[model samples]
Target: MHRRIIAPGALAAASLLLAIPASAASYSPGAPGIGDPYYPYYGNGGYDVSHYDLRLKYQPTTDELRGTATILARTTQDLSSFDLDFLLDVSEVRVNGIRAAFAHSGQHELVVTPRTPLAKGTPLSVVVRYHGVPSAKTAYGFTTWHRTPDGAVAADEPEAAWWWFPSNDHPSDKATYDVSVAVPDGMQAISNGTLQSTSSRLGWTRYNWRQNKPQATYLATLALGRFDITTSTSEGGVPVVNAYSKNLGDNDGAARASVERTGEIVDWLSGYFGPYPFGSAGGYVPDTTTGYALETQTRVYYSPKQFANGSNTSVVVHELAHQWYGDDVSLKGWKDIWLNEGFARYAQWLWSEHEGEGTTQELADYVYASHPADDAFWTVKPGDPGPDNQFDIAVYDRGALAIQALRNEIGDKAFFTILKGWPEKHAYGNASVADFRRYAEQVSGKPLSALFDTWLFHTSKPAAPAARTASLAAASTTVAQPKSWRTIEATNDVHGH
Candidate 1:
C-alpha cells in the first residue's frame, strides 16, 4: 500500500510546476458499507448460530462442494415466515436432516424457509447437505480451487461459509466460528483464531480452526495448499503465524521479518486503539497471479509478488489496522465505507510516523495532492450499491483525509482520544458517520457539524477560506523544520504507548 517517495528536489519541482487549478472529479452511486438493498434486515436481531456443525468435503475434480451444515437457531420474534440467505453455487439442499424444499433466488444466494413458524425465542435445528462448486464471483480476489489443471486441488476463501452456511454475512453480527476444512494430503489448511485440533480420515486431512472471539463472516477465512508454515511470537507475547505456498522460495526469512513487523504494528495499533481485537495476528501469502491483499480478521492474504521487493510491509500495516477499524468496529452500511477504508489507509501514514519516515504535514500534503476535488464524494450514498463498488480510492483515501481534517481541527490529544475510545465504546459492534461525528463533537467540545457535512457528505471538496489558508501558510513558515517534529512519536509515548 506504500509507494516509494519521490526525491525532494523532484517533488518540489513538480509541486511548483503543477500549480494550475485541478479539475473536479465525478461521482457514482455504489454499495453501502454493510447492508444490501436486497436484505434490509440482514444483521438485525442477534443470531445464535451455535447449532450448526458443518462438514465439508470438497471435490477438486469437478470444482464442487459436497457438504452438510447442521443449523440450530432460535427465533427472537414470532414468525409466519422466515428466510435465510445461504450463498451457494449449486441447488441441492435439505432441512431438518432431510431433503426439504428450497429454491435458488439468484446466482449469489439461496432462500430457505421452514415448513412452519416457531414461537419467539423458539429453537430449531436443521441440517442442510449440499454439493456444488463455489462461484468465483463470490470471492473478492482470492479463489478456492476445486480441481487444478495439473490434478492438484485446493480450496481457499472458505467461500462456503457464505456459499453453504445460512446466517448473517455482515460484520455487525459478530459470532463465534468453528471451521473444519478437509484437504488432500501434503496440503495445509489455515483459518482464523486458534487451531483446536487436526484429524486425518480417508485420503484427506481435516484442520480445525475455532475462534472463541466474535468475528464477522467475511473475516472468517480458509486456505488450503501445500504450505510451509513458520510460527513465532510478538514482543508482547502474542502468537504470530505465517503461511506460504511451498512453491515460494525460502519463506523463513520473509516469514520471520513479516511476522515480527506485523507484531510490532499490532502492538503499536493496540496501544492507540485498544487490545488486539482478535485472538491472533498473522499473514497468509498464497501462490496466486493477482496483485492484491485482503485483511481477513487476524490473518491477511497477500500475493507473493508484493513480497518480492519488500513492498508487502505496507499492505501488512494496512490490513492489520483493519483488525481495529474494519474488523472490530464495522461500518453500518456500504455508504460508510470510509469508516472501514479511511481508517485503514490512515494506518499507512501512522506507520510512516512510527518509522520516523515522514512529517504529518508532508503526509497530509501527499494525501491532499492525490485527493480529487469533485462531486464524486457523495455520488455514492451509503447503502445504495453493494460491497464491490465500495473499495474505490474515494472511500479509502478521501475518507481518511476527512479523519485527518478532524484531527487537525481538534488537537491530536482529543483526536486520538476519540479514536481510542471508539472501539472500546462500541467494540464488536457497528457504527455510522453520525455516531463518529457526535463522539468527536462531544470530545473536542466543538461544533463540528459544518466541518463533517462539508468534508464527508457535501458534493464538492471543502475549501478553506482564503484567509484561513493564508494564515496556515504563515504559521507553517514560523514552525520548526518538518522532519524534526515528531507528532506521532509524541502521541505514541502517551499513556496508550
Candidate 2:
C-alpha cells in the first residue's frame, strides 16, 4: 500500500478554507455515537477513517491474539478527544506517530486525546497496541470473531467490530484495509484482498493481505486454522482462492467442489449484477462450527451446515451476490438492511430458477406460505424491522418477496435495469430504503409508492399475484437443467448473517 504524506502547508490551507468563520480554537470530546436508532454506540464521530493498517499476531495454543491497529483518518471537526470502538486489552496509544493520553470506557470505547488539538481537514494517524484472547460476541446472534474447533475466524456484522480490532465499526464508515495476520508454524492465516507476501521464521508464519477498495469494518474477516488452501483465477483475470478445513476427511470432495464453483457463480452473477466489485473473490468454509455464512467482502465464511448438505451451494451464491448489494451499495442505516438481504435472498431465487428448480414466483410463494399469514414472521415490516428483528426471516424471506413483487409489477426490463444500475449508481457508498423506491419508480416510469408501502413497510402480508410472478418466470432467460440441481427449491434456512 502507498503511504500518503500530507504536507503541513497544504493541510493548513485546506483547514483555513473550510473554517469560513473561525472564531476560537475550542475543542471538546467527540460524540460517543453516530446516531443510529438500532445500535447507538456502534460508530464514533469527529473523524472519518480512510484506511486501516492492522497487524495482528495470534497464538492458537494460548488463544491470545496480539494486535496493533494504525488508523489513517481525516479530522471532520476540530477535536480535543475522539473514540474508537475497541473491546480488548490495550497497553499504549499514539496520535500522529507520538504517544498520546488515552482511556477506555464501557465495553468497547477507546478514547484518545492528542497532545495538541487537531484542526478540521487535517489528516492524522493513530496507532494502537494491544494484546488479549479474542472471542466472538454477537450482539444479535452468532457474529464476529468466531472460535472454530481448530482455530478462530472473524465475521462481524451490524455491530461487532470491537471483537477483533477497533474502528468506527459501522457500514457508513467504510474504509480501505491492509490486514496482516501471523500464526503458529502449522496453522494458516487468511484475510481479505490479494496475498502480497508470506514469511516464516522462529516457529511463526505471516500472511499479508491488502484490500485496496473501501470496505465496511463488519465485512472485514480473518480466519486462522487448518485449511486446505487453493489458488486460481477466473474470467478477466480475477484471482479465485478457496480455503476450508482439512479436518473434514470424508466430505472433502463435496467441500472442494463447492469452493471450485466460486468461479462459475462469479461468472453467472456478473452476467446479471455487473462485473465483480473487488480485486479477488473466494470463501472459507471452516469445518466443526455451527455458525452461519457471512459475506465478508471478497471472501465469505461458511458454516459446517454447508458441508452436511449439497444444497449449501446456493448459500455461496447468495453471499457472493452481496458483494454487489450488501457490501458495495451498503446501508445508510440499519433500517435499510432489506437492501442487503432482500437482493441477496432474491438472487438465490433467481439461481433456483436459472438452474431449473422452482421459479422465483414459486419460491416466493412457498416461502411466504411456509410462514402463516398470522405467524410472527410478518409482524415486523422489513423496511423498519426493529433492531432485534432485523435478522428475522422478515428481512431475508419477505424482503425477497418484496423484491419479486416489484419485479413482477415493473416487468423484466425496468426490474433488471434497477438490479444492475442501482448498485452502480451508489457504488462503494451507503443507500437507504427511500433511495431504492425512487430508483424503482424512475427506471420503471411508474408510481411505486403503494407497492413499496405494502411490501416493505406494511404489517400485513402483501398479496402475491400468481399470474404476474408466472409471467416473469416464463419470460426470464433460464438455461438447461444441471442434473445436480435439487428438484425441490433449497430451503431459505442457512441465512447470510
Candidate 3:
C-alpha cells in the first residue's frame, strides 16, 4: 500500500444439529471475533482456516457475483457454533455435507449452526452458496468493490474477502486459495498466484488460479474486465504475467511501461529481501476511480491514476517489496502496519539509490529535514498509530526514517542481515512490531529499546545524531542538487492502499 504525503495533513458462530460429540459437555459457541483492538470483528476465533476453494461467476451487465466457497479448517476449540466473515445474501450453507442453519448476525458475520458439534483439532469442510451485487453492499459506510466500465475488481486493505467469499478475514489467519471465476467469454478474470487453466462453455469462460502458499483473506482478489495480458519469465525464472485494461485512456503506455517491469523488479528486490515469496508475480491496471494502488498478494492492483504523469516504477517497487515483507510475512495485527509500509517505502529509497537518483541517506536526510519538529507529522507514532491515523503520511515517510536510523546505529552488516533475516525467520506468518524489534536486537547484538522508543514509540521528534546532521548540513551547501532528488520525494504524492 502506497501512502500519500500529508503536508501537515493526512488521510462467527457455530451450531450443530447432527450427532453430538461423545464429549459434548465442552462444546460452546466460538467468539464472534479474533479480538484485535483495531478491528475486533475482523476475524473470528475458535478456528484456523487452511484453504479456500472459491467457485464464482460474475456478470458485468448486472454486476451480480455468484459464488460457492468450500472452506477447509481445523477447530481450535470445541465449537457448537462459529462465524465466517461475509456479506451478500447466502442462499444455503452446509457443514460436513449436512445442511446447517445460518443467519446474518452483524454487519458482515454469517453465523452457522451445524447439525453436529465440532470437536477440537478436527478438520472441517464448509460450503457456502450465495450471490449478490457487491457494489450495493456497504460496510462502514463504504464499499471496497470497484465497479468499472467493463466489469469489477475486488481489492482493498484491511478487508475485501467479505465482499466476495467467506473465511477467516484477518492477516493472522493465512490460508492457501484456489479461486475460479467464470465471466463472459470475451472478458477476463484475474486473481492471485499462477493461472492453472481457462475453460469456456456456452458464453462464459472460467479462469482458474491457484495460490499454494498461505495468504490472508484480504490478499485474495478477483478482477474481471477486457484486458491485454502479457506473459514472461524473470531473470530468476519466476513466471511473470501482467494485464492492463484495454480502455485505460491516455495512460495505457505509461501503465504498461511500469507494470511490465515486474519481472525485473522482482529479481532486483530478491538480492536484498531474499527470494520472491510467491509462485508467480505480476500486476493489473483496471479502469476504476480508486485513488490508490493495492499490493494484492501476487497480482498487485494499480489504479489508472498511478501512471497519469508517466511511467512510475517506484510504485511498482514499493508493491513488489511487499510481496516479501507484507504478503509473505504479514502483520499480526493492524497496529504493526509500519512493518509493511515502512519496509516498502524504504525499498523505494533503495531503488532510487540503485538508479543513481540519490543515496538512501540523502533521501532520509531530506525527509527528516522537510518536516519540522513541531509539525503534527511527528506526533503520529508509526509503531502504533491508532486506527484513524494508521495510513497517515508519517507512517510511511517517518517510518522509513526510523529504519534508516536503525541502519546507522547498527552498521551496514548487521542492518542488512536483519532486513533479509527478519523475513526468512517469519516467512508465511504474522508478526508484531515487538517481534521485529526483538529480532533486530538479536541480529545486531545491541540494546535497541532506546532507539525504538525514540524513533517509533515516542510521539515526539527524535534528536538527530551528529553524523546524520552533519551529512545533511553539508549536502545542503552543495553547488548542485543530487540527481533525481526531487523525483524521489515526489513519489509520496501518489496515494496508495
Q: Give the winner by TM-score.
A: 3
Q: Which is superior by TM-score, 1 or 2?
A: 2
Q: Please, what are the lDDT tens digits per residue for candidate 2 over residues 176-208? A: 999888898888999888899999999999999
Best-matching candidate per lDDT: 3
lDDT of 2 at 458: 85
Cα shift from native, residue 380, model 2 (Å): 2.1
Worst 10 residues of 3 by lDDT: 2-11
Q: For residues 345-418, what per-residue lDDT tens digits would candidate 3 score against the true structure?
A: 99999998999888888777777776667889989999998877777889898899889989988889999998
Instruction: Tally clashing residue pairs in candidate 1.
Output: 17
Task: Estimate candidate 2's alpha-carbon lDDT, on a 0 to 1 scale.
Answer: 0.77
Q: What's the CA RMSD for each of the models? A: 13.4, 7.7, 4.6
Instruction: For residue 198, give model 1's deviation from the true position in Å.
Output: 1.0
Q: Rank the candidates by TM-score, best first.
A: 3, 2, 1
lDDT of each: 0.58, 0.77, 0.85
Question: Residue 386: error of model 2 in Å?
Answer: 0.9
Residue 479's C-alpha lDDT in candidate 1?
A: 39
Off by over 4 Å in 3: 1-25, 465-497
Task: Tell me the TM-score of model 3.
Answer: 0.93
Which is the better candidate, 1 or 2, if ranked by lDDT?
Answer: 2
